[model samples]
Each structure stands twice: as structure tokens, then as C-alpha cells.
Target: MQFIGPDLKGASPMNPTYIEQLFVKYAKINTRSDPARSATPTTPGQTELAQLIATDLKTLGMSDVQLNPANGYVTARLPSNTARKVSAIGFIAHLDTADFNAENIQPIVHPNYDGQDIRLPGATISVAQFPIFKTLKGQRLITSDGTTLLGVDDKAGIAEIMGAMQYLLAHPEIQHGDVAIGFGPDEEIGKGAKQFDAEQFHTAFAYTLDNGRPGDIEFETFNAAQATITIDGTAVHPGNAYHTLVNAIGIAQQLLNHFPENDVPEQSQNHEGFFLINQISGTVAHAEIDVIIRDFDDAKFEQRKQWLIETIATMNQQLDQPRIQYTLHDQYHNIGTAIATIPEIRELPLKVYRDMGLTPNIVPFRGGTDGNFITQKGIPTPNLFNGGGNYHGPYEFITVEEMVTAAEVVARMIIAHGA
Candidate 1:
């Protein structure tokens, strides 16, 4: 299988002219995911971005370029260009940003960054707060204007994958196997991968370009779930209120009290488990509370989920009828357990980094990723870097150097495996 592609001049991993263009083009779209929405994508922008990327994949001469409107996942395949019996591999990235204001996202480019305080219209990237900037001196930096999020969390990953695909397509001299890649929505809220069709996405193993830093690799992620509790009460006039009158709002407050104050999301950090009451709604007659649970340890994660169920049960016993009912949905578990089975998937990226004169930095992510669900399915899916920092906020930024480096890592992994 052969196709003609343009000779991309000055487009190596070190020189990221092609990748930077793709980053800027993707970073401008407003694809902020909504957890509240019941749809798979939860936002129209995600599907729009998927459509654009799908078109680009077709233009790049990829096969099976399908944009699934049902789940907002764009899947494509680049058949093996070599006859060396190379095993097919997969790569994935999300299309949506975090839950923040994402309207008219105008990216600001910093050429030859001076490593100083970067003041934006809505926020400032302080050096004292983020010392990582000091190390990246004289590089091309991309940031938000401060009013809205930069949307670089997964967009950078998307750009890296697309850029690498373009680079691979052009330079057919770099022999590789069949490459399968996908882009989906609602990763921030942790619902995107729930609808992924792993059986359909055939691959021997996969990698997710969702991590941060140049050499970042993550096999362990937070064991995650969400709980929604609803309360029903009898509202009566204050003047005529008696033992018969039950206040649902007061019961909602009591449920909040049952959670540990110090173990909430705001107070917790790396490796610590927490129960977060993300959304609360109440009235005298009806009330509801939404909570998300997280822990890296499997046993401890179960304990957290059990505690919620037991607390709700105890509260129900005190009521005349079981007025409190809740639903718990497990989002994803740690990929470490799954990735451990296939050692090659984990070692491939590390070898690539070491060969590139970079050290492999293994991180236990505090949050979940699309890889969690995919890894749990069957094929081992480890995570690689997206080359960005300060994710899910206004201070978010991505560097052209690291973005291209990440793409190179992806390409090299294929060459190493295929060879």
C-alpha cells in the first residue's frame, strides 16, 4: 500500500513547524465537555472537532475514517506499509476540554520564552508558582489569553497524533506496522471512554497521548466512580409544621456532614483518596447531591464506595420510608493492573525516551483517562506524554518542542516494534 504525500520541510521532531500549526489550529476550538449533559459527547463542540479531525484523516489517506456521531469518537487506520508481519497498534486522544469556560479560545504564542512571569488578560503564569517554566528557556510556548481555558489538555495530544500521522504518511521510508488511532469526547468528566468500542478498535496493544511532561508515563490512575443521591420530603407550612413534616433540604445537609471534612478533593493530593460533593440541589420537598470518588489503591477505593452506600442506607433507616435513594456508576480503574500483564507496552515508550536521551518519568496520575477503560477491556494501553502543564485551568500551556518530541516517540515505538 503506497500513497504520495507532500515533502514537509523543517518538520522533524526537534523542528516542530508542522506540529505547531496543527496545535494552534486545534487549540482554538471550544470543545469543553459538560458532565451535566446526558449525551455521550455532552457538547456539540466535541462532535464538531471530531468531524474536522476525521476529514483531516481522510485527507492524509487513512482508511476506516469514521466519525461515530453516537459516541463522538473518530477512528481511523493506517495499514501496515511494510510486509514484515508487524503487529497492529492503536493510539488514542480525547476531543473535549475540562469543565471550564471555553468560548472563543484565542491562543497566545510566546517565541523564545524569556522564562519570566507571564501575565495574561485573566491570569498570570508565575515563575515562583510554576518553576517548571525555568527549565524550558528559549522555546516556543503556547498559552491562553487568561479569560478562558487554553484547551491544551488533550488537544495537544490530538495534534501530536495527527502530526505524527502526517509525518509518517509523508516519510514512507520509515517502515512501520498498521497504526490505529482514535479521538473521543467527555474525558474530563470521565464518560467518554465508557462508550468506546474496544472490540472494534483492533490492536495488539495501544498507547494514550494524555500524560504531561516530555518523558511522562503513567500506568496507575485513580480508581474512579460517581454517586448521585436523591432525597424526598414532605413540605408543610411553617405555621402548621409538626412531626409529620420532613425537610429534604435538612436531610441533604446531614448527608454532607457524614463525609470527612479533611478528606475532600480540595484538601487531598497525590495518592490520597477523597469523596467530593461536586453538585448539590435542594428544596423543602426534594433534594439531590452528586459526588465523585477517587483512590489509587483498589481496596481503599472500594472502601470509599462502600462508605457512601452504608451512609445512605443508615440515613434511610432513620426516615419513615426509604426516602433517600442513590445511584453509583464506576467510571474507571487503575491501568497499572492491566498494563502489568503486557510488559512490552510499558517498556516501549521508556526505551524510546532513553534512546532519545531523555529519562522515563513514571507518574501515578491523580485522575482517570480514556486508557483506563481501554486497558481494562483487553489490549494493554499505557499512557505517554501530551507535553503540557497546568491542565484544566487558565494557566495551561504546551511547548512546540515537547509536542513534536511526543510525536517522535510515537513513531519510534512503531519502528522499534516493527523492526
Candidate 2:
């Protein structure tokens, strides 16, 4: 019952080394997306990663491998090898890394971990900062050398999907329905799934391999939105007088004070909503403050949005003129609403973990994923684990063995559904 690869008897085992090699190759690529850019892929490296994945899928005996230039999405299909009629499903992953220093990424390998502080060139992966290192004491861990992010937030996911497809193709003995694969760009910047075509993916449901460990299933994510407040100040000579000049920076500070001090990312936990100030910049003439709002409950999410609108109105009343302007846009919503239509999709992973004799770690995802937006597009997509830890930072790490487990879970999920 230790389903290391395909759950079926006599099924071929997943190549852990193969998955590791692919991960290392993809990780070395600097696919960091730029939020400053409005382009679809955001960066050139993301389009490059998408192209590479399309070629890999084609070489792995996949059909209909198409790379859409408009949005940087690489989608393919593994035609059904069985006669049974079943719905097609998919596995998706993003190609870009988070916003961090991603140049010259050197993935260091600790073949034998000793449970000590890992000193690198720019930083240290210590047990104190990340106590989870103790649980992964002796595993073969891969990490960045402190100068850059390891890109494991999603590249590990790409490798797992590739490894799973390679295994299914090499064997051919396992009967299954059509299996779809999607690799998109700029997910780190929260813009990847915006242009995804659910009809083109042609899947009844899909799983996005994001940042998490094996045996973990995430069906719920935060209802997310972005808010920006722009203040226009009447810049006058400081010597001329304080009464005529309105300091925009001072108004920005006053606006920030209106936000709940306790309701922030660092203070919030499971199911707790937060208001994160993503960016704030400007001079006395003009200033802007960007915030991100997230909540699990729809009512609370709406209320949070209403609070921002009301706060802006009340603060503008005190001013001589209405110089404060704002813009509010939804980023994504919780996947719970979409998946509720297909309750079985959420339960399948639990059964897969039980059948594999692994404990199920079902929890509410504190952040949003590509699945949140993809689900809103009609397909019930939930998040699967990529077997990595401490994502989006220098201390990020993942074990090769866990990568194999992630690949195995992909294969098992496919068979459990359509085989």
C-alpha cells in the first residue's frame, strides 16, 4: 500500500533521479516575473520556460502540445489508452519564480543532511529560523546558496508532472483516459491564470502542483483583491506657509492608520483575514499606497472591501477638497465555492492518501494559487503539493525523494479518476 509510483500492481516505479534532474535544470533558469511589466508573461525567461516544457511534453510522447504565444501557456494531451469513456483531467504548474534575486542560481545538494545550521555565501539555513529542518534531518535536501531564491515554488511542480508523464508513457501497460498538462507563466505575480482557456485545456477538473509537501491537500484559498489609494497634494513652498500646502506623504500615513493594525499578514493565521500593504511610494506632490485584502469568508471579504471604500469617503470629508482617489480590483477568490459543485474532487486526494497509507493533511490555504483563478474559469481545480518547503525565500528546500512522492501522487490521481 506504499504507493511510491502508480498504485496499480505491476505498475512501473517513478524515477526519482529523473524527477530530480528535471527540477535542477528548471531551477537553474532565472524565471522571476516582473510586476512592473504589464506583458502577459511579464518576463522573457518565463516564455522560455514555457517553451522548454512544451518541447519536453512533445518528446515524452504527448499529443496536441501547443504553446500559446498570446499568454505563455503550454498545454498538451496524453490521449486515452483505454476503451473506457471517462472525462479528461489535467495537472498544471507555473513557470516563473517569485520576486527575488534569481540570477546565477546554484542549487546545492546535501546528499546526507546532519541536522545542523547550513551556512551559505549570503545567508544561513538554520534550524532556529526554520525548525522544520529537524523533521527533514537526513533527507537529500536541495537549496540555493543564499544569493538567490531556489525557484522551487513551482519548477519542482513542472518536474513532477514531466516525470509522471514519462512514467506513464514508458510503461503503456497502465490503462487510463486522456491526461492533460498545462504549464503557464507569471503565476508568481498572480497573473498567470488570467488568460488560461479552460475550454482549450478540455479538462473536467485539474490539480495545480504548488508549494506544499506530499500528503497535503488544499481546497480552500483566500478571497483576494488589490486596493490602491492615490493622494494628490498641493505642493507649496515650505517658507510660504504650512496652511496652503497639503503634504501627500502625511495624508498617506493618516490613511494607513485607518487600516486595522492587528489585521495584517504577520499577525494573521489559519482562516484569519489580513490587509497587506504591498507597496507605498511618492513625494509630497503625489503619493500612492497599494494594499492587498484577503479573507476566507465571502461576507467578510465584501465587508473588508466596504471598509476601505467607507474609510476613503470619511477621510476625504475632512479635507478641503476631495484629492484622494482609489482603485479596487479583485485578484482572485477562494476555490471553495467552485469545488463545492464537485465535492468528489476534494475527496479523491484524501482517498488516494489513505490508499497509499499516508496521513492526509487537509488544511485551508492561507494564500491564493493559480487554482483559485482557474476554478473561477469553470473547471474545479484544487492545489496539490510540489514537495518543497519555505518557498519564496533563501532557505527554501526540497528532498529528491519527496519529489518522487509528488510525481507518484500525480500518477495515482490520474489512475484513480479515469483509468
Candidate 3:
């Protein structure tokens, strides 16, 4: 099981070092996505990582290796050695980290971790705060040095997919159909697979390695939409301000006050939906409020959008002018609606997990993933775990053994498909 890499002297695909090295190397690269930018990747660091992954894919003897700068997607293909006409399978992970502190990430590896409080420079992962650490006892855990995020949200996923591919390449006797790999950028900002060429991806179906914990297989996600409300105001001299002047900033605050504070991200969990005002900025002359709405049920999602429109109309009527201009558009729909027709896509992972002696935990993904967009484009893509905990922040951590297990599960899926 511990076969050394031909190029990476001491690295073995089965050994946790192989995936840990890749994770540590990738986590150091600051690929944090910016939502304010309108470009495909929204940042240059993503392109840098994409290029690095492309070179690594070629080094792994993968074919059709391509790094599309226009979209910031790095993809490659591993041809099948079997004669059976099995449909090609795809595995996807994002290149960019979340919008947290991603600069100067110092990944610290704790080998043979005992159940103890891990102290970082600015943050601490206390056993009391995260009881799950007790379960990960005796495993090698990787975390940030506390000045920045660990970037294991999707970097772990990338390393797991790469490890699985390397394992199959080293063991040619394990039969599998064509395996396609895609590393997308800006998934943190929900634009990772927006420009993904599914036809060119050449896969009948896919799975996004972008969730938390092992044995998690999620197909249900929130129906999402984004709304931008622009408020215009009249500016006048102080002498005439009493009757002629209007403050857009004040109106923006008033509009926000109308939204129920209890119906926000912090107050809602599980299947409950919420309307969150993520960003708001402006002066007296012009103001803008950027909000996001999420709900799992189609009826509730539509009602939320309708409520926003009605709130804007009510504000305009009170102001006696069209000062508040707004636009609400669908970002992505729930993937469960599309995947419901294809039972095999969901059942495959369950069967794989059972065969691997792992309990399959079918949970509703509280947020969205690349699978949401790709599944809408004719692929029944679900989400698998990246074997991490406390994602998207400084307290994020993952065990080397968990990542190795993820790679083994991925390899098992491919082998099962070829059967």
C-alpha cells in the first residue's frame, strides 16, 4: 500500500503524506475569491493555482490536460484500460478558498494528535469548543497557524481527487472507466462552474468533493438568489434641506429595518430559509444594498423574492417617488429537483459507502456547491465530503487519515462503476 511516487521520492498514494503534502502546498497559495469583481475567477491567484494544477495533472500522466484561463478551470482525463463501454465519471473540486483571511497561510501539521487544545498565534481550537476533536484522536491533523484560514474547504478535496487518480495510475489492475477531473475557481463566490463546459468535460455524471466530514453525500441544496437595491436621493442646501433634501442612506437603513431580523442566517438553520443583507454602502446621493435569499422549498423561495419586490414597492409608495430601484435574479436552483429523476446518482454513493463499511449520511447541504450549477446543465452531480471540519474560517482542520479515506472512497466509486 505504501508505494513511493516515482517523482516525489518518499510520497506514497496510500500513505497520508502524499495527500498531506499536496494539501499543505495548495493551502499556502492564496486563492481567495472576491465577490465585488465581475471576472470569471474574480482574482488572479485562482489562475495561478489553476496553472499549477494543470502542470501537476500532466506530471501524473493524465491526458487532455487543459487549463482554461478564460474560465479558470483546470481539467484532465484518465483513460480507461477496460473494454466495457461504461459511461465516463467526473470528480470536481474548487481552486479558490473562501472569502476569509487567506494570505500568508502557515499550515501546521500535528502528527499523531492527542485530544488536547491546539493553540495558534491569534486563534485557539479548544476541545470544549469543538468536541469532534475527541473523535479524531490519534490521527494526524492539519490546521492553519491562526493568522489565516486553513483553505482546506476545497483544497483538501483537490488533494483527495489527485491522490485517488495517482492510486489508480499506480495500480493498473484496478479497472475503471474514463475518469475526468475538474478544478474550478471562485466556488466561494458561487461562480466556480458558471462557465464550465460540461460537454467538453465528457462525463455522464459527476460529484463535487466540496462538503464537510467523511461519509457525507449531499444532493439537496438551498435554492438561491441575489438582490441589489439601489436607492437614489435628492441633495439640497441646508437652508432648503427641510423640504427638498432626501437622504438615500437613511432610506436604505429604513428598508433594512423592514426585514425581519429573526429571519437571517444566524437565526435560521436546518430546512429554514432566510433573507440576508450581506453588503450595504452609499451616501446621501446614492446607496446600494446587496442581499441574498435562500430557501430549499420552491414555493418558499418564490415567496421570498415576491416579498422583496413588494417591500420595494411599499417603500416607493411611502416616498411618493421611484427612488428605490431593485433587481432580483436567481443564482442557482436546488439540485435535488434535477437529481430526483436519477435515482442511480444518489444510490451509487450510498452503496459505495456501505461496501466501504462507512455509514452513509444523507444530509441537506445548507449552502450551494458547483454541483448545483453542473447538475442543472444535464449532469446529475451530487456532493461528497472533503474530510474537513469548521470550514471557511480560522478554526478549520482536517485529518490526514480522513483525506486518505476520502481518496479510497473515490477510487472505490470508480472501480464500482467499471463493474
Candidate 4:
């Protein structure tokens, strides 16, 4: 079941090519989730996209299609046509784009590149910044024009999932058991599974098609948490400010100085943990700093948070005035611990990829995903690839061949689970 061409009328817009068609539809919609907002979905655009996807699911003739407004999670059921003894499985993808630059993304569809530095109007998608760009020498690559992200991170996942479902529906002869579909909002900000209703989904296992690079099927991610350091400062007249004023910015900087400079993200990779300061702002009267701690090991992750607490306490001792306060809030944790108990669930993606003539790269995610949250919920969920690269940046790309292949993997996984 191959994607012969673009299903233009069936999709939002008529894409000239299959990859172009998918990118056009997703890029046109603005689905950036706001982290600062207290809303469930975090952005209204996500709900709009959820409604649209629910309608698409209905048109595909899937059953129990419902777009719950509580958290804007779209869920659908595909009852088994065969009497195979298999667990019901689910396919999940997020609807919201990352809070990064995503304005008016113009995707460049180049068919069979000659392996040179592909140049956009304003910038170059060079092989230097991304050496893997050389790996895709002759593949048809779809990339942004160096301004906004391609949104291939999860939209590519959505398109691939939809394409595979369409294939399965068309080919009734393909034996399979119950299949579930789920799409969420605010995944980029770590709240995608916060309000996800597992009961409504009713799946024994699931997979999140959200990863960079093809053939990447992950079962582990970093345990994550955020901490805030607030400082109070007294401002006095310059003439009398010498010894009476407590500069909040200076205190905040001193607290950050406690962490090892080499452990930052720029210098860390491949399972190494780090403490990152995501936001910082201060005035003479007050200051606030937001810190994120990430690690795959629970013990180390805890130690990282404790280090922040101890650093703040140590900083407090240096100041004669009580001008600082700190708070550490746990955000999400690694799914490996939970999934370890469900080893059978972890082997599904690997088997699917192997059956598809692709070797599964079983790697640990330095970041996190909705899969982590679902794993903690007692339903083992891993992640699959959506044929994307350079995520959360303007140079993000997904190949047409890769997208079609990913869809085929989804269909194969469903069929295997049913078998």
C-alpha cells in the first residue's frame, strides 16, 4: 500500500506533491502552544486543529470519534475486523507546534538533490551545521526557508498516521485488531499527557510518532523539572546605595555560578545530564530566574534539583538581608523505569522496523515526550520517528520517501499488534 500521489481534495489543500501536500496543510495552520497561559490546551489554535482532525477521522469511517473539550484530546476507535488475539494499540501525535519561531514557514521541495549546500533565499541549509544533511544526498527534502520551522516535528507524524490509516481502511484484506488514534495539544511544553484520558483511549500499548531522524524508535527520556529563583533587592539613592542596597541581579548570577559551566546543554549530549537556565530577568527591586534540570537517572535528577536548593541556601548565607526565595517543581520523569517492567511493549517498535527492512535505533531521548507520561500511567508507550531532522529550528526537514515509509511502519505495527 504505497502513497502513489498527493490526495489533494481529501486533504486541506491540493499539494503538488505528496510531501508538499502534507507540509502545506500543517504549515498553514498556527498551532503554537503558550507555556505562560493557564489554559488546558494552552492555545485556541490547537483546539481548532483538534476539531479539524476529528472531522478527518470521521470521514475515514473510524468509530467513536470524539474531540473532548476538557483537554482538547482527539480520540477515535477502529474496531477489529478479525478475531486475532492481540492487544488494542494506539497511535498518538501532538497537535501543537513548539513555542519556537513558526511564522509563515515556506517549505522548499527539492527532488533528488545533488548533495551541495542547499541555499534558501536568505540563508543556507549547509552540510556544515548539519552533517547529516550529507546523508540525504539524493533524497527529496522539504525544508523551511530559514525563517520559521517546518513544523515537521509532529505534523509530519500526524500526516504519516493519517496516511497509514487511510491505507488500512482501503485495504480491508489487511488483518488487524483494534486500533486507536489520539492527538494532543501542548506536547512541546510538556503538558500533552497532563490531561490525557487513558480510559477514553482504551489501549494496552501506544506509540508517539515524534522523533528526529528516520529509524529512531525510543523507549527512554530524561526526567525533567523546573525551578525558579526569586530575589528581592533594595534600591537606594546612588549616593547612599553603596552598602545599603541588595542587588537582585547580582544574587541571581551568584546562584547560577554554583553549577559546573561545562555541564550545559551546548557541551552535553548522549545521556549526560545538565541544569539549564531557560529564563532570567531582574531589576534593581526584584529578580526572577527559571531553571530546568534534566537527567535519565532518577537519583541523579534528584541530585540536580537538590544542588539548586543547596546552592540557594548557600547563597542565602552570604547575604545579611533576607532577599532570596526559591522553589523547585517536578515537571516530568523518564519513562524507562516504567517501561522496563513492560519489556514486551518495548519490543514492538523494534520488530516493526526490522520487518520493514529498517534497523531501529534504540536511543534515549535527552529531552522528554508524552510517551513518558503515558508510561507512568501504566500503559507502556514508546516513540517512533516521523522522518524529521533539526527539530525546533528553522532548518527542520522531512523527506517524502521518509514520510511514506513512516506511514507504512504505522500500518505494519497495527497489523502486527493484531496478529
Candidate 5:
């Protein structure tokens, strides 16, 4: 298959024209993942996008292009042109978008955006709400049509990586080592990198282009786990429901109320951890709730999980029956511990950014990425920015210039490795 789109044969590395075009093209594809689906890639759209990316890589003269439908990972290699045998580096981005309305995404382009409230059909990108918009003045901003997410969470990462690879291929005079690219699916559902073949990827270290905001380099992420609480109750007639009938919904609500309301996602920021009861469903006879526990610190993470266990125990004791049943499973751990051992992984990107006159902002990410699992697999992968804001929602936005800068950073990293 051939890459189908505009001709980017001799495009400059600094030019964001093709990057912007690719962002719009890829964002239009519906690649939203389904957490309920217990399948690799989770949805058909992810496979479709992975195949399309494989075609694009091949068209860009990438070698050894392979698209694995089983894992929905599209991988390709750009063989080093430099004489020195430099260690290979890999760049990865997920294909699937977050669980949001991602169908028929209409990307609205605001050229030379002024700092103000930009109104959409049912939403508004207000400078007051997101003060970051003020810094984006005089830049072209791309957003969704207020009905769907912009899909820029990692698609912008994909475009930036593709743009960097295309730039390297176009300008063969730029010396670089072997560059491997991997685009995986089901990342939004936390299963994208579970089956990632580090042996096949063949890189000393990799970077997940899945973070947001310019100048952001993330190595620390939340240690995460999921808990499901179920309650069983006896149902009886409303008229005869004096002491015989027990409402499971009320018990579920009581369990939720026990959690510290102040320590939730909405009120927490920076390094603070939170317990989020994201989903609830119940009736008079039965009820269930899904909660996720997250923290950056290891001990704190364990305490958060212990709190949930104790809360469940207390609820069960209060009911005088084992009515509340729960299952807690570890999802991913913080990558900071691994990255600390190898300072080069973090220092390399910092050097590249500093050399490019960009201030590198090392942030502790509140959420987990594919890097969390990939790092646990012995490949110390960190995260780089894709240059977007308000991700996973309708107000999401990114600028072509920011994406271009991100691409340049990727290219610089390759060059630094080669030298």
C-alpha cells in the first residue's frame, strides 16, 4: 500500500504544513478505543489507522515496515545513514483516542488566534477558563467542532513523529542513527503496550510521544490500580419493605460517601493522589461501583489502596454480612524509579531541548501512559510532549507551530544520538 495524501517529498523539517495536514487527516479517523472490549486494539478503527500509518511510513522510504494486526502495532525502521555505529532509538505513539465522542471529527482551524473566547456549537474555548490560550496568541489553533474530542492526545504525537521521520528521509545529509517507529492501539484503555515486543522494537531506549504541552518531558507517572465494588441486597414489596428489604443502591452510596470527597480528581493537583469513583450502576437488589486509585509516591499509592480495602471491610462489617465484594488489581507503577537509575534517558532530551533554546519542563504526570508498562518491561521509555491542551474533551486544541517544534525536538534527539 502506498501513502495517500499531499506530496511531502522535499518538505523542510521546520515547515509544519504537512504536519498540520496529517493531524487533520488522522484526527478525522474514528479510532476511539472500547474498554469493555477484551480484544487487542479493542476496536476496528485502530487497526485501520495502524495500516494507514504503515502505508505512510513505507511511502516515506522507511525500511522494514511491518504492521501486526494481532497487536495493532505498526512498526518501521529508518536505517542509519551515519558511519558510526550508534545505539538505535525508538519513537512510539498510540493509535487509539480516549473514550469520548470521536466520530466525524470536524477540525476547526483558527488562524492567527487572538486571545479571546472562541465559541463553537455547544462549547467555548475561553481564555479565562484556560489561561494557556493567552500564550497561543498569533498562532494557528486547531480544535474539534465542540461535538467531539480533537483526538490530538496522541495523533499529534503520531504526526510529529511521522514528520520527523519524513524530514530525516528527505534530508539524507542529516546524520542520524537507526530510528524505529511504533504505533500501537488500545493505549487509551491501558492495554496498548502490554504485549509490545521489546526484542522486535530493537532499541536501547524509547520515548512515548503521548504527553501534552510544549517543552514538557515526563518520566514520572501515577501508580495506578482499578477496584470494582459489588453489593447484594434482598428485594421485597414496597409496602412490606419495613425491615426485611435492603436497598443495595443506598449501601453503594454509603460506601462512596466514605471516600474523602476533598481528595478526588477535581480537587487534587500536582503530586497529590486521589480516589476516583468513575462509574456507578445499581438497583434495589444489586449495585456496583468502579473506582481507580492513583498516586505518584510508592508508599502513598499503597496507602490509597489500603484505604479502599479498609473501607470495604468496614462496609461489610456494618451490614453484618459479606454483601460487598470487591476485586482490586494493580495496573501500572510509576516510571520515575526506573528512569532514576539511567540518567541518560532523561538527560538526553533535556540536552536536546536546551540546545534548541527551549526550556525543558520536567513534570510529574498525573496519569499513566504506555511508557508505564513499557518501562516495566525493561525498556526505560519516558514521555515527550505532543503540544496540545485540554485533551480528552471537546475543548482540546493544538497549534501547528507547537507540533512543528515537537517534530524538531524528535529530529534533534536522533541527531544527538548519532553524534
Candidate 6:
């Protein structure tokens, strides 16, 4: 794959041109993190890209360039010049894209979009499918040609942090405390922060530039868990299988029937929780089931997991084989509890954005973030938007205007936190 040259001729750290260049730079790289691999980064592309970012930080005069050998985690330090000592703050972003396809991501620049349906070179992006396009008139936007994912879920975040750092280095007169930068791999597979060196890359608080839409400041995310079930049966000749043979497929269907139809992903929204049956495979002799459970409330999430366990026992008795085995695994939790204790960290960014004439939209994340894990690890971390929508799919997009605003917002947050 050829690298697309980012045109940064007219771009500044706080303008659409500069942010667009950064997005273009990050988007052109194919760094998909793999879930099945045992290696730290999981993908070779992620390690390559982490080195690229580390080089950039060194060129920008950031000190303490340390790249982790285990997971390809990258970290840098920017010392503060403020007279009064302030708490060190961290800004984090992921280096890898989703496990989706990333062959040739052709990004289309809508230079001053009229808020209508946009037709890419191919049928990759369309306004009719994404109604949110109506709200972005007169704003320059970037979209993939629909062949691959845009990678804005966290790449846009990486750009925001980089652009803000460039701005701060250019203007050192700005009073601020120490700033820490971290980029991790395998976030898409829920393992990005597993090998993160929190003690080495120390900071009092942190914020993940990984979310959807602009003005979105999130401190709460869904509690997540995965469940797997296996069923066994005996196969017999069809001619004599009337009563002796047990169809494991039928038993799998019985488990699905046990779940409430209304509690699925398609029908639920807001605080409504769901039990999603993601994968299934079965035959007369063997069968396997995989399910994902999500909810904002801890009690509801636990209940959802318990329901799956009870369903397996009930089905085993109905089949009279008792050959069903189940396994449950927890993924992550909501950061609301962590943020509630450190109200200053939650309110600081919102106050900074509002002071800049921007309306801070407080939203609950229906998904988990690296911040969820960092918060529980003793760092006050929250999730912030990078001005992108419809992530992890070919329809993903990022507004040039929103990316620039995000840079400004981040710079402002650092300044306020130092004070």
C-alpha cells in the first residue's frame, strides 16, 4: 500500500486544515489489532505505527521516549514550565484500528459539505444511511470510499493528541504542568491496556480521546461480559433416529427462546440492557454457543449473566443428557464511580469547553473505553470525542472542523488542569 501525502500547507494546530492533515496521516496507515494473537500488539502493523508515533514525539522535543517491548506501548513526557506546581495530566489514544478490513482506505474530502447525501467514488458512504450528516452543513468532512473502515474510532484521537502537543511546544509561554502521552495496541479486542505501564508513565489523571461525535464528555460506560456454552449429543442413523437421537441444534434454539426478544440490541436503547447471541455452531454430537451481555447498571449486568447460566441448566434437564458446560468472562466496567469521587477531573474539561463558547454534551457510553480500565487502575480518566461518527465500519467519517475544535479543547483542558 502506498502512503497518502497529507497536505499541511495551510493547516495550523487549531484549524481544520491542520487537523485534516493529521487525520489523513493516521488514516492512511493500516494497523488492525488482532484478538486471536498472543503477542502484545497482536499485529505487526501496530508495532510499526507505534514506532512512527515515537519518532514524531522525539522530533517534537518530547523527552523520555520509552516503547514497551511486550505490547508495543509508547510513552513520552512534556515537562511543565508553570511557576506553581500542578498535578501531572495524561492524554491517551490507541494505535491500532479495528479487526475490520483495511486494504485501501480512500478518504474523500467534502470541502464545505452542503449537508446533503455524499456520494463517494464508490457506494461506501451515503447521507441517506447516516442522518447525522444533516447537522454538519458548511463543515469540511472526511469519509472513506466505503472499501475499508475509516479508522477514526481512535486514530482521530491519536491525531488530536499529537496536534495539541505540537501547539503547546510552539507556544511554551502557556502555563501548564507535566503532560504524559500514551499510545496502546489491541484496544479493539479489549486488550489494549492490559500491558500498559501505569507506574512508569505516571500521571494523576488521564483522558482517552476515543469516542463519537463532538462535545461528548463521557464518564460512564456499559459493564460488559461474554458467555460460552457447549452441548453434546449422540448421532444415530436417520432411519432409527426417531427417539434415540438428540438434535443439539434444537437444544441451542431452546436456549435462544429463553432470552426475551425485546431485550436484544436492535430493540434496546438508553439504559436498557441486552443479551446478544453473537455466534453459534452445533451438530448432533457437538455444539457451541457464544453470547455477549451489556448493561450500565452492575446489578442488571450480573443478572443478565446469571440468566445465561440458569438457561444452560434448564436446557440440560430438558435434553436429559446433562452434557452442557458454560463459561463466563468479564471484560470491563463503567467509570462513573471513579469520576464521581474526583469531580474536579470530570468538571474541568466541560468548564474549559463551555468557556470557549462550545456546548458540552454529557452522554452515557453504551460501550466500554480504555478510560474505563484506567479509571479503575487509580488514574482519573474519562472518554472524549474526536469528531467522528459511525466508527468501526466503512461508513465512518470525521469532520475537519470537529477535529480542529477537539485540538483546541484538549489544549484548553491541559491549561486549565495546570492552573
State which candidate, 4 or 6, has the greater lDDT: 6
Put down candidate 4 lDDT per residue, 1-419, tens digits, no spaces: 22333442232211225434755677657788898998978888888788888888898888899998898899988889887677798899999898677766777888997778888875788788788888887878888888888788788888888877877777777788898989899999888798888887888888899966668877789888988888999888768987888788888878778779898999988889998889999998899998888998899988888877777777778789667898888887888877788666777777877766787788988888888887777677888889868888788888877787788788877876777
lDDT of 3 at 15: 51
Backbone clashes in each candidate structure, one number apiece? 0, 0, 0, 0, 0, 1
Q: Write the per-residue lDDT of candidate 1 for residues 1-419, one digit (tens) a residue.
A: 22133222334443378778877888888999887889878988888889888888898888899988777899999888888997799999999998888899989999999999999988888999999999878989989999888877898998888877887787778788899999999988878887888888899889889858888888789999999999999998988888878999999999899999899878987789898889999899999999999999999999999999999899899889999999999988888887888788877888888877778898888887788888777877878888889888888888888898888787778777777
Indicate the worst ten consecutive residues by lDDT in candidate 2.
1-10
Output the lDDT of residue 13, model 5.
Answer: 46
Better of 4 and 5 by TM-score: 5
Models 1 onward score TM values of 0.86, 0.90, 0.88, 0.86, 0.87, 0.90
Which residues of candidate 5, in runs, are more than 4 Å off?
A: 1-13, 83-85, 114-124, 128-130, 234-258, 314-319
How accurate locally is residue 276 in candidate 5, as Cα lDDT from 0 to 100? 92
Superposition error at 419 for model 5 (Å): 2.1
| Native-to-model Cα distance after best TM-score fit, residue 23 in candidate 4, in Å | 4.9
- Looking at model 1, how many pairs of residues clash? 0
lDDT ranking from best to worst? 5, 3, 2, 1, 6, 4
Predicted structure 5, TM vs. truth:
0.87
Q: Could you tell which candidate, 1 or 5, scores higher by TM-score?
A: 5
Order of the predicted models by TM-score, top scorer first: 2, 6, 3, 5, 4, 1
Candidate 2 regions with alpha-carbon error over 4 angstroms: 1-12, 119-124, 238-243, 282-285
Residue 180, candidate 2: C-alpha displacement in angstroms: 0.5
Cα RMSD (angstroms) for every candidate in the order listed: 4.1, 2.9, 4.2, 4.8, 4.9, 5.3
* Deviation (Å) of 257 in candidate 2: 3.2
State how far residue 273 of model 3 sits from its true place (Å).
Answer: 1.1
Give per-residue CA lDDT, model 6, range 1-419, as digits (tens): 11112332333346455567767877888888877889888888788878888888898788898789875789998898887889889999998888688767777788888888776666645567778888888888888887788889788988888888877887777778899989999888878786777888789889999966777888788898988888887789879998889877777787788889898999988778898999999898888999899999988888888878887887778666697888899888878877788778888888877766768888888888778777767887888888888888888888877887788778878888887
lDDT of each: 0.85, 0.87, 0.88, 0.80, 0.88, 0.81
User: Model 3, 280: alpha-carbon shift in Å?
Assistant: 3.5
